[model samples]
Target chain A: MQIYATIAELVSAAETADLSLSELMIQQEVANSGNSRDEVWAGMERNLEAMAAAVKRGSTGEGAFSKTGLTGGEAIKLKNYRATHQSLSGDTMLAAVQNAIATNEVNAAMGIVCATPTAGASGTLPGVLFMLQERLNLTHEQMIRFLFTSGALGMIIANNAMIAGATGGCQAEVGSASGMAAAAAVEIAGGTPEQSAEALAMALSNLLGLVCDPIAGLVELPCVKRNAIGATNALISADMALAGLTNKIPADEVVGAMKKIGEDMPQTLRETGRGGLAATPTGIKMKMRIFGQDRDFE
Target chain B: MVLNYKSVFDIIGPVMIGPSSSHTAGAVAIGHAARKIFHAPATTLTVRYYESFAETHRGHGTDYALVAGVLGLPPADPQVPNALTLAQQQGLAVKFIEMAGPSPIGHPNTAIVTLSNEQRTIEVAGCSIGGGTIEIRRITVDGFELKPSGPLPILLVWGAKDNDQRIQTKLAKMTKIMRQQSYNTAAKHLVEFDLERSLQQHEVDSLQQGAAELVYL
Candidate 1:
């Protein structure tokens, strides 16, 4: 059986146990109602401004912004997907995404169904929702609520720990995202926060040491299309959570495990190109070639 | 019971990937954000996915997503992976590489989406977080995390007086508008507006332009 007496108890435990969740809730705003949302927004804005200031101080450099020109080239492809979905009006957002990706796009496509987030990860939520929606079509509001729920979970991960490749490794970023998304999916489908947290704990517990090492360092290499994979995992986690298979360990504990794993990771595997696959000769050659440091340059 | 509406689950998942939603979906979101931000054709580009993306990138279809993104593919595009091969076949010289070390601490799925021509490189790092929310983290051309999620249709105005304050104010106004217009409703507008503003700001150009790009699988 679970340890908590109620959902509030579980959330409180999570909040106290983790920084991300606590921050996401923005503890200062105890007042309920619409103002809470505003407070969240304000908190986010303040963080953004502060981050900007840090970036200016040269504290935070370009993490992944180096590949700007690629987006322009990708426009035509995305447009086609959008066109197909738009034509299929009145369809559920999940279906629209699935259909769009299935028809026009290429290497891989995944849908985010019940607890969807970024469009890149769009398929994950839709994919889950599609399967569930066919059984029971929920409204758009429900979908949004699912996302909000997921967002709440995501904020926890984002705050208390790491959602970046450099800090927590890839597991902390995508793994955390998938966990939150899974929690959201289950919640939207009528699961409880215990279920949501369980899903998150399950997801994170499984993906403890994922690293963030993009091929070529471009979002495209494994970045943009990884949504399909993220989506799939989100569904898997959601289903497990819904099924009542909870992680005996709390979600916060799992996050702690993740952070410790990341900290213990070698620099090469820590998105630093010093370890893991990045240390391969091929990787070295590739790095040289990409940076114009290859033999040809000599 | 007050209906604890949190989307918590008891048993969920065989989650797809991790260490980054930004590196994954956030990246695609960035691609889509770019399409909406530029609303123009992108002829030349230099993409970089960090270490995680570079390693197992083929499995994740980041290549396809970037190509599809450049071509204006939606976030939901299935051919995101195939788009890269398609683009390569088209002679776009869509190069790929692995980057080293962490550049900054914002969103992990950070990419400098530069809408450019031979004359100018209007670069921007589209920071896509979970749920398709994006922020123009910074512009390489001019250093500033001017919120790009606004509907004001303003330029980055590099070095413009009160640019930061202006952007912040605009974003505040936009979020206010979105909240007022759809208070009870979940605000999709906020996400879109935020991305739009980030895309137009061209923040990514300032830092990682012409550098090695990485992708994680």
Candidate 2:
């Protein structure tokens, strides 16, 4: 019951056990937590159901405005636009983007969300999972397996590197989420475990040093739109890995690099709303507008 | 560290009501833990919000969530936003003091909660480490440090004037004790026990009537 600390070890364990990454993860969960496989699957299925419900409620444009009135209805707008007009990104990608936005919008509006790694980046995995389910004609069980695969990757990152924006940054929140989703997408597409790791590396490297700067210190504003971008990043990385693209650095090394960068980052960049876009003039105006004054935040 | 992720739920979901996981859910968890430590509803409470939590907790609903937690509401409870009003109606005198600068413990999102009644006081400090998970960094009853985490049942016994053997004899009957630690100062003796199975409510009340405090983690 030793914890797997790196992608290489997890892949090796999967190979030795003669199981896929999702199967290995399920086994590990049963061993570590004393839960039956059926019980674990039931729990994951519940989360999947909740995520689907959030997506449905959010996409319908039902009370999406957050408390600060910053971000709302953008997901519905995207869904509507995709319905009437042809998007250059195609229906599958557009659906991923829309679902991602929808989930995060629900989160901002204080609706329940399944935090894929964290609530601030909750949208990416569910977005890609539901979209690919339709496009690939995947079953419910397959979508559950995809969540298991993503969970395995997320566990490794959280154990070895970081996953909290306060501890690392948005690079740790959305970036880790993007990596998890990309790896899951690779698994759903029938790629090897190593290929999935490559997808994660590619996805994370693209988002290194990303800050957690929510406007007015709310999880609305850029957070909801960023989930859209994170989902798109996940899909693109998954496609590249499926097409035989590889990262120059190993996935473990890239995760280490992310941890190092997070450590070196100033406090202002790590969820304090003191730097990045949160410090912009528009950001200040929004804060003033929401709170009715320039409150002494710092 | 053991990297405490035992299931996929810890990674992909807590299925919580939230704007920020660390701020809202984690804050609720801290308050929940504090409530458990007190063994009864806190008649009076003082909560200290530190650093980033002090700055933006209102926006994230951390303030409401923490109050809801102490009122025995779960993180996903819909009434969390109205917890303060509920606390007022319940006659729980709660006060919040926003502390400037980061905690000495270094986590940006931290809270120290003190719960008290006419006879006793307990203080607990906790950090929400994202994704609705939390760590109980410190706990002090009187002046002795006690550590408890998760949902296990805990028993704390402070002997009268160093009468440690009297309490140890009483604890011998509890089934499936997971951990036991003891602390001693000049005037008092403290023994902490963590159990696999929770003590019955009657058993908890019996212990409370004595010199012991039974806490459910």
Candidate 3:
């Protein structure tokens, strides 16, 4: 796609170049509009809350569980079951995250994922930081510095790619998060933001077009599991960026590409229940057979 | 820029949980995806979180967050708690997993959400990085990876995907025109902005106004 080509050119121009992701983000935000950095950052958080509410509402609607008539305690029990058995390996960062989410610690740690601003993607980074610190003996200051560095790359991805998955897909969602993590890992390991952003860009570009389909409208099956992979990708992308191997695509161009790919996506692919895994026969059968209705087919 | 000398930490807003703006928002996107994917009454669901998501799920209210999404609630809806309850009352099972291992390729905020039926099971893996953005990482039926984003019936409509050819073509030229004109009236659409503004205004009464503004953004 031309979008991909532009992004490749942009990345090439940036490869081996020196720049911080945060700096890039500030530049991107400024380029996008006149909203103050703080204003844009605030908007990011607001969007986060909006996204949160949307998930909750979807579950409560006539999507899932309305047929069996489950209970709160049952929900908790089910949650526990999910916690007990699920495993995907990549790196130590993945391990730490696994421990945290199983324990419910991501939201409290202040991870910082850099949506429109730093506070928006709080869950991913903090969880990774806390896990790394505990397992890797990373210092508090190191964590903070790492965050700053990671935020820099995150900003780049936000500027280059669609940070909002509704605007794109999991490629933008986890891909951007992993980009930040990759950059932060680089920073924590003593790489420059230039290196970090490169790694981040590489990560985003690599993990594009991942979908966002949850069965019965829940964030279970693959939502939480992908975070582990995203974390691991962050580490790997950092390594790739550090090793001096990256697509010659500008982060912004990648963002542009992501937006286009998402546009080409069908409603089912776009988080609307119309495409991807959501449209499968199993998905349809689950809805119809479980709910005792034919609406799934209709 | 003058040296206002705000603390560097001060420059940073409230701390939070993650995936990334894209991942987190992407999770919401997945919720939206689920809403449209099934097109039926989502009755019972099972959510399983992997590595990073498990650790931070609680603070992010990822559990409730996803549930809220399933309920068709907006991200700013304070009724997230009620929605969780409502899910249970309706007989839905939302699960959380901490996948403790590795994978060749994927995001950190991944989840394997299963919406089952008497005869079939649909499993989806969606990642929420940061900013509540979500994307479908992978999907499984009888244990197989399905490229959900590649030939699926779904489509994402936004500023980035407004047209077919141009890059970053969200809403084609509409978003461009809006951005250029600054005429997009999100003031009434987003609730969180109003709530944040109310809080920023330093007025007590206006706080709820901001809170009520949680929707429409």
Candidate 4:
């Protein structure tokens, strides 16, 4: 089986085979690994199970503080707020925000999480998928298929550009994850592969050049909230694509631009804990406190 | 079976403990891969972190993750957070070094570790590039760098130099070899095999009894 490194090639292959993007990805896995379809599907099912478990444990787990005590209870706070008050983002979007935050909370607490492209940006996909499952009443198979769909596009990003924050910044981490979630959303909502591509481009463009700076160098603060916003970003992008909207630039070019931007980014902005939020007064102070360092920044 | 494309699992899986994949899980993977390459229990372990790995080791739990790996814990093990205590209880004398900023040595997420048993001391260096994926940069045992990449279900077999034909003769008796690549370096011959599946421990034990220096799954 030939590999598709770009959105155009992937869509063309999907159309030629008359298969949904999810099915094409499943086929690709079976071909590459010499595994039966059932085996490949079962593998993705395990990932889905892990992701769902993270979501559950994150929301309900007690003493949720991260090892650093920097990020912990925001997801729980959101859930409580949602139950008592209406959100401007609406229930589905807020639900996505809730789940995304919850999942990252689990990650920050050193709990197990499926790296949807990466652990740093792990929450966005599940944020959207679990909310969709609740809203659309999707079958277990549909939930698993959503992962295969997103994972296929994520591989393209990983190969062509990258999904690493160190190499590509948050644009590549949460940004790519949001784009993957958007594409998967379109497909699960019965949109064509082409529409999913547009959705991906829109999602990437929305968060282009986002840096990967965490206060104290922890996956707390902006990183956790970023997932919440990333979930909403995917939701809005999917809606636009499903509503017959499209970006002027192709999806592949957006990924390319992300790569170039990340390359041009300074080392400090790329997970070095030296710039962006990590360089701020409070961020630096917190870093000193957490690490017990006395090297005061003049 | 050198795949030109990555599997989807490469993107969506590797369920791991994390505040950061490259720092935490990647460190665990590096430690675990080093342990696998050693193929023996280690007593004294010295770990050195470089660049971003050094800077964020405290917040990201890179220290615990690396210790967890040296202790033979998998990347996702919940025991990772308790690794420092666990290592002490297990009588593993562990030393961790975090390099100061801007050293001219390694990638952002790099780990250079030396593990010694009573008889042998081995050095392994690995880089966690991103997304829970890692590249094993160097290994002291057989210089596992000549051919850095291969198909999965791989085995790095250490033996005498130019022993490919001899190892092949030995390996064929065990299982069909889909593909094989070998290089002789640092007085060690390393043969990488794309096998039908991961070899069972008994099978590896039987193979190690041959002239093979070490066999790692």
Each prediction's TM-score against the native? 0.45, 0.90, 0.46, 0.89
Chain B TM-score of every predicted model = 0.51, 0.74, 0.53, 0.73
Interface RMSD of each: 12.5, 3.6, 13.0, 4.6
B20 Cα displacement, candidate 4 (Å): 1.6
For B14-93, candidate 2 gives per-residue lDDT tens digits of: 88887888888888888998888777766888888886677677678888888888888987778887899999998888
Regions more than 4 Å wrong, model 1: A1-151, A162-257, A267-298, B1-25, B31-42, B56-59, B78-94, B97-115, B125-135, B141-172, B176-217
Model number 3 iRMSD: 13.0
Position A39, candidate 3: lDDT: 66
lDDT of 1 at A274: 44
Superior candidate under TM-score, 2 versus 3: 2
lDDT scores in order: 0.45, 0.81, 0.45, 0.82
Native contact fraction per model: 0.06, 0.57, 0.14, 0.67
Q: lDDT tens string, model 1, A1-298?
A: 0122332454766566753332333332222222455554443343223222211221112212222222222323333445575644333333323422321122122322111232223334434443444646776445445544555665455545655565566676557666776776776777766778888888778778877554434333344334434545667777888987878998887877887887777655655444555556765566656555421100
Local lDDT at A126 for model 4:
93
In model 2 chain B, which range of ten residues has the least summed lDDT?
Answer: B161-170
lDDT of 3 by residue, B57-90 (tens): 4423566657666667654344653557878887
| Docking quality category of candidate 1 according to DockQ thresholds | incorrect
Give the lDDT of residue A156 in candidate 1.
Answer: 51
Off by over 4 Å in 3: A1-127, A288-298, B1-79, B83-217
